[model samples]
Target: MVVGAGLAGVRSVEALRAHGFGGAITLIGEEPHRPYDRPPLSKAVLLGEIDSTVVDSDLGALAVDHRPGVAAKGLRAGVLETTEGELAYDALVIATGASPIRLRGEGPQHVLRTIDDALGLRALLRQGRRVAVVGAGWIGAEVATAARRAGCEVTVVEAAECPLAAALGPVGAHTAPWYERAGIDLRTGAMVASVDLGGLTLVDGSTVEADVVVTGVGVRPSVDWLAGSGIELDDGVVTDEHLRTALPGVVAVGDCAAWWSRRYGRRLRVEHWDTALNSPEVAAATLLGGPGEGAVYDPVPYFWSEQFGHMVQYAGHHAGARLVMRGDPVGTRWSACWVTDGGTLAAVLAVNLPRDLMQGRRLIEGGQHLDVDRLADPAVALRDC
Candidate 1:
């Protein structure tokens, strides 16, 4: 039985049967809707250019029992006790996913995490009201872009001195003009002291009036249902290199899973689409209790965002790294590579440059000792090396 039917769970179901695990598989998900693509929910779906149903996985084609709208409340050893009832399993995967952070206030505000939230926000956006978005994270920024496209005046309030300070750091945040040109009223270091019916009250006692507000502070893993479970928890379900949890016969993947990354030598929790797609491949192979083949999930963590017609691509993590920039931040056609103090590439972020992201992903995966001169040359093709 699968505990969640998001991208990871759906992928696991197809992969298990393909790998000759012929046992009866029951896929359980809390959301009533079929397993759908969440990445587009913030982009095309929000802009009303794509339907949510378009991304749902065709589980019936794979001949698997998919139980949507069923919430799993508890797990005991190899069995799962859901809000509906209980089911036994030889192997269980936890793909409960993450939930958006709701800011505490007099807020009847909307957040764009779930499909339901996206739909509700889309309806509210049709009124063409002014939107005040709190937090300048990727989700907040993307939602702001959607709001702008919907003809809503967007204002972003962030506590950090620069947008994306926590995730992308100063160099990346310097690309703020991209949002400014898109007509986003970005207010940095603006502490939200209180929220009222009229709008939000800043720490300086100024009010930003808005018809609607969205708080995209961040997301917390949906591991609250497994709080009683004996599995190790460190912000998310802690798993090994093989994606096995502290408990036997149970594995965790996707946004809810935090595993030790061999490449970065750190316990990383990635709430990314590709991580959800590929990480579970490791967990399924490890379930047999045998020496796995070509094991170890050391793939570079990657993510992308489309806002204001620019495809912003990021590969790898940039924690404690130097920004090796070779781009005109305003021109929006260059790439920036995050390098370690010793000069090894930690990550690469590109705007409107897919080739750099593609080849940089290979360099990261291969752990190649990059030629510094070649990488610095803007004219040299990455494939030429």
Candidate 2:
């Protein structure tokens, strides 16, 4: 039984069946709607480019015992306690996903996570009203871009020195002008001290007025259901190298699961879509048989953001490393590589350069070190590194 039908849960069902486990697979989701792709919710769905109906429905054609609209409240060693009732399971996969971090305020604030949230914000966009976005994280930045494209006056408030600086770091976030050039009033070092019925109050006593308020602040794992489970929980569900929790028959995956990383030697939780896709296979493999060998669930984290006609891609983990800017940071096309121990490739951030990311990703996987100039040079194939 899988308690959550988001990306990881859906993929787990397929993986379990593929691994020749023909057992009954019951996939439970708290949302009334079936599982759908979330990455598009902020971009294509917000643009009204996709049909409204399609955005609200399932994309994967898997036949699930999909218990939509049912919420799982708790997890025992071998049973899932839901709003409906308890169900027994030989092997259970927990993919209860994450929810958008609700910004502090009074009247109203929008978060761009679900199709429902997107639809509500889209309605505000169609109204042709001014939009104020607080926080310049990935979602916040994307929504600000969408709001600008929609012809609404957009104002972005960010407390960070630069957009995504904390995650992508200083050099990557320096691309703030892209938003400014797109007619977004990008304000940095601006904290929202208060939010009113009309606008958000900045720390400097100025107010950002808007018809609709949106905050793209971070997200929190939806592990409220596992309150007294006695399984380890920190920022997310803590699992071992095998994706197994402190308790047996209970495994967590997706945004809600934080597992020990062999590469970095720490338990880290990543909220990207790929992590959701990758971790469940390991869980299923271990549950179906043994660990001699399940895949280590160590695919370099990768994610892309589309803004201002540029395709930005990032590969691999970038914690505790010094960033090496290979290409021009101010240039339209460039690559930034984060090297660990101030040397070997740990991750690569590329803008409009898929080849750089592809090559750099390989170097990171191989744990190789080579000429920095050789990899940085556009003429040289980074595969040589």
lDDT of 2 by residue, 1-385 (tens): 8988888888888777767776678999888876777888888888888734332323244445888999999987887899999998888888998988776668588888888998888878843578999888888878987888788999999998898877787874767988878888889989998767898988799998888999788999999889898888898899987888888888889999999888778888889888888788898887787543566766677888887777888988888877667667677888887778856898888899999988888888888876776766656776775
Error of 2 at 263 (Å): 1.3
TM-score each candidate: 0.95, 0.94
**How high is the CA lDDT of each candidate model?**
0.82, 0.82
Error of 1 at 186 (Å): 0.7
Q: How high is the lDDT of residue 301 in model 2?
A: 76
